[model samples]
Target: MPDGYSTLHPAMHGMVNIGVRAARRAGEIMVRHLNRLESLEVIEKGRNEFVSAVDRLAEEAVIEVIRDHYPEHAILGEESGASGDHEYQWIIDPLDGTTNYLHGFPVYAVSIAVAQAGTLKHGVVYDPLRQEIFTASRGQGAQLDGRRIRVSKQISLRGALLATGFPYRITASRTDTYLDMLRAVLIETAGVRRLGSAALDLCYVAAGRVDGFWELGLQKWDIAAGTLIIREAGGRISDFNGTDAFIESGDLVAGTPKVYAALSKLLAPYARGL
Candidate 1:
């Protein structure tokens, strides 16, 4: 058993193994497609949003792995949408940073999360470029490449390094509010990073690489895996309202306990009605 797996829920052992397998398979597909980006077929899902042939192929590979091991399990894939509707569902983002991958920015990842009755049970985020795998099972604690990891010991938001994502749509309605929150954080914290991949950003928080992370307009697949990992790593996560509604609202705030509270306080006033 792995270091963190010793404390994992007994029933979750197999599920976590399956998730890691699926994520790794997807990672392989992603890396194989990297060298041939110029010839890959790409589609504009919407303004500033894209889906590539590689994304579909990777998603297919992930689902195939899950189905092979647990044919009855449900799946919610970024490229395929929801399927099966079982008590056990796999949430997948075969390529979390499509734009970054397309640009060969080397910050993308494969994210796989499992949930039972809407409650997250296990998560796996695989970075193909770095060959690092971050895993977490409910109550088991998080791990980076088989070594246990935790959130930064930073006690407060002051001087804490944070990571975030810009709303890609960039609509006029939310622009000012987002910028205001960003400006406030930039002044109060050591610095902020607008990383392209939310899945990896959350993992970085879990691994103590960054003290906190927040983002808007995220799908469940993007944050699901990272959410479990961060919680297991002893970090706190929630929406701007300081509630568990982040998954529904697509507005997230997460950090070490103290940092989370401070950041949430700073961003809440600006998130009214969001």
Candidate 2:
């Protein structure tokens, strides 16, 4: 299957090839460390927040394999910064939903995206516990465990299931943004879910499991790959104010064409300057 895909595309072939292998290997490292007592030993990164050694180890494990498999590809990881010299850069989030992982809530994932010359070319997001892997190449669309998937055609926010995450570390009431976002979706959508992993949330949108998503104060590593996955799966992604500055603004809104427009209008008042 890998070889078959490699022969079918050229611009993003290396990304597909390396992403699958790296995400799987990273999942292995994560699953092997699960439920172990030592893993729950966490250090405070902020008020009432913590990061376990597992997060660091997992990030290292994923980055090491990515480096070994494609020595030329640069990497920008959540736990680690950039490295390598190739034009192709891999954006990685070794452990998204860290709090959930530590609490055994089971909503974490490892995301890997490869971009060439600043544009996303391909990517993968692996949910180790469920054993589901979502992958996408720039124009090839998104897939889950090798089956193609897409965003919902839901045209109204009132009927959609929305997703979001809270941003911590820099300020108090970090959950405030999530709370506001939650309120916005709840009053209209069928439901709002804080699954704890922004990466997987985007994948869920890509797979049509969720109709839309929005968040404030997220890093590139959290949504870079997932952004491409959602976009390729027939979803629209833009800055909260409907600009193309998602990478810099750290605020993004995404959904199907119709769903996107609805969500955009709802979010417009809050994203005025950004």
Candidate 3:
């Protein structure tokens, strides 16, 4: 256990432990197969949506750990789908950046989050390539490899680095709308990055590597863990309308308080069907 675990409440600590265990297990599987991508099987889940044998194996690795420790907890996984029916649900994205991973880009991650009664309680995002583990409990704050982390204090969008992702469903009706918003942000910010991993993008916000992040068409498994980590790291998150509906809306903007407010203002028009 790390020194930060000594400060977390018992239950929260246990959840974090289990989550870290699961993420590490899955991450190990990913790392082991990282060099053998050419031999792996791949499938297209939807237009531009992909899955691979590595994703299935990693997801099974994660589910196995969670099931062994908390058999009754429901699981909502990207590869395996949902299992069990309990108030406690574990959301798992065994491999968050599949496209990048398939291309050997070294930017994917294993994301895990435990939510009780629909409220996130504990979360973890582990980068197998970088060997970075980001964890957070609802009120226990966020940590990066045992050290406390916080969002950047950048107060303005100008000169602030931002991160974002383009929805995989580029042929959808809203692609133009999304592109417009991206253009606006790119013109106003110091730089904008498209990392292909929503989980890592949010973790970057928490680690202060990026001042803010926004994205669309993300699933619960994509943002659940990272959202809790950001909030606990002294950042704010919400839908384009500035409501607590981002999780359900699949559209989110997050950053330090001031940066969040600026993003909200810039994105509000697009959110309103403009």
Candidate 4:
């Protein structure tokens, strides 16, 4: 067990342990595959969306570990899709930045989250390149490699540094709206970053590396773990409509309390008819 594992709620011990182990295993597979990207097979799942052999192998590594310890638990994986329909569902994205990884851009992660009866219980986001793990269990707070972490104290958008992902996969009709929204946010904040990995982007938000993060068209596996970490770290999250429907809608806005409020207000107009 790692140093910080003991600090989480006892009820979450088993899940968190398995989550970390699975994530690490996936991370190892990702690193090993990085050196051989050219020889790996690739597939296009959608316009501007892709998957590589490494993604499947890494997800398999994660799922194998999870099934070993909790064979009956449900799982929702990026590569394999959902299996089982139990109360405890493990949502995982074994390689979050496949495009970046394919291009050797090096910003990706292994994300895993467990939800019991539809409520998030624990999460783990592991960055293989940096060898850092961000973790949280409901009501136990968030941590990075065992030390506690908190959202940034930046209360206003005026100087806040925010992160976001472009909705490349579903941008055909929403391009103008998204660009306008981006323009609004960019003009108000210090700047914005379109990092290749949404999981790492949210983890960065939880660690206060960025004051906030928002994105559209994300899958459950993309934000499940990071959302729990942000909440446990004392940050706030909501759909563009400022509701708790991000999980289903995949349109999310999150930040420290004050920043969340400010950003939500600014983005509300853009979300009016959506």
Candidate 5:
């Protein structure tokens, strides 16, 4: 399996062989592009929609490493839409926070996920600035730089610090969905933060830095990789409506079991139904 697809869930042999190699390769390229000395060309796809040359270069680097090994694996990325022809796909955010990167905010990351038959099996979220790497494989639990990590054990929203992300495309059609959630979390939780980077937001949830996270109008690239990391870290994830429609609808909430329940209740008022 040149693309690492044949390794599937990793047989103890391929775990270190393929997954680690791909992740380290992606991280290397990420560092190369994010050196901050390169001439970054920021382009806006919409009002706040941003893409940069670094994004494309980063994606190309990841694509090459993944494709060279698994030419059959499909790839769904932010800068480059979708490609390849395989049942298993690699979802990626070459640069998870282009805005933050452009502004030198030191909060961007590279998120990578592998899914088979639409089920996420493995994920990697790397923060180049911190050189921190988070990884997860189905039933294997989550790990940060090879050490196991788990979500916080917080039991209630009142005691939990939560994270969230709002779509830059928040038009009139989606305004209330954003504002209502913000207000609900603000009133019910200890604190609320809009980190702008969905990947890091979910990573924080998995790492226990934040007890919970939710967002509306996200894409696969934004949450796919981080979602697996959360689940494998002993966290729970669901749509705003408490369904497994996070990927399909791009509406999601994730946290430790207790925090998720509390936050879900707080968000109930604004959700579709009672």
Candidate 6:
């Protein structure tokens, strides 16, 4: 365990510790299989969405840990569907950025979050390539490798560097809508980046690496951990309509309060009727 783990909020110490362990275990599986892509079995979940053997193995690793310590806790994982109906649910994205991983891009991650009675309580996002762990508990501030972190203080959109992602299923209507939002932000901000991992993008926002981020069509496991981390790091996240239902809507815009507000305003016209 890292020294920062010692500084976690006392009340959430157990859950955070368990989440970190599970994430690291899954991350290890990803790292071990990262270079051996030729043997991996890949499946196309949808038009452009993919899953691989590593995803299943990593997800199993995560679930094994959770089940070992908390058998009654439910699980909602990307590779595996939901299981065990319980008040305590663990949302797991065993391997985020699978496409990047398969291409040896070194941008993938393991994300895990625990919700108690429908409210997010603890979250962890581990980038095994960099060995960086971003974590947060409901009331405790967010941290990176044990050091506290916060969103960028940039107050204006013109000077902010933003991140976003294009949906996998790019229908004609979806493409036009996404492009409109992209163009609006591209013209106003320092630049826009598509990192292919929403979990890491939100962690970047929490760590001040990027000023803000927005994307549509993300899953619960993708944004669950990252959103909680962002909030704990003095950031705001919301759906296109500036509401707190982003997890349900899967359209999120997150950043420092000022940047979030400005970014949302910029995309408002394009998001009308969404």
**Each model's TM-score?**
0.94, 0.89, 0.94, 0.95, 0.89, 0.95
Against the true structure, candidate 6 has what lDDT?
0.89
Model 5 local distance difference test score:
0.79
Greater lDDT among 2 and 3 belongs to 3
The whole-model C-alpha lDDT of candidate 1 against the native structure comes to 0.88
Weakest ten-residue segment in model 2 by summed lDDT: 1-10
| Structure candidate 5, residue pairs in collision | 2-69, 2-70, 3-69, 3-70
Q: Candidate 3 on 178-219: residue-level lDDT in tens?
A: 888998898889999999999999999999999999988789
Write candidate 2's Cα lDDT for 1-274 as tens digits: 3434432334445657667666767777777778594536688876745667777787787777777777777888776788877888989888888888877788899888888999888888988888787888887888887778989989998878888776664344545545665677789889877898999999999999899988887788888889889988999999976666888667888988899899989877656643
What shift in Å separates residue 247 of candidate 2 from its native position after superposition?
A: 1.6
lDDT of 2: 0.80
Which segments of model 3 are wrong by more than 4 Å? 1-12
- Model 4 lDDT-worst window of ten: 1-10
- For all predictions, the C-alpha RMSD in Å is 2.9, 3.1, 2.5, 2.3, 4.1, 1.9
Model 4 earns a TM-score of: 0.95
Name the regions of candidate 6 deviating beyond 4 angstroms. Answer: 1-12
**Model 6 TM-score, all chains together:** 0.95
| Decreasing TM-score order of the candidates | 6, 4, 3, 1, 5, 2
What is the lDDT for 88 in model 3? 95
lDDT of 5 by residue, 33-61 (tens): 66653477778998878888878887888
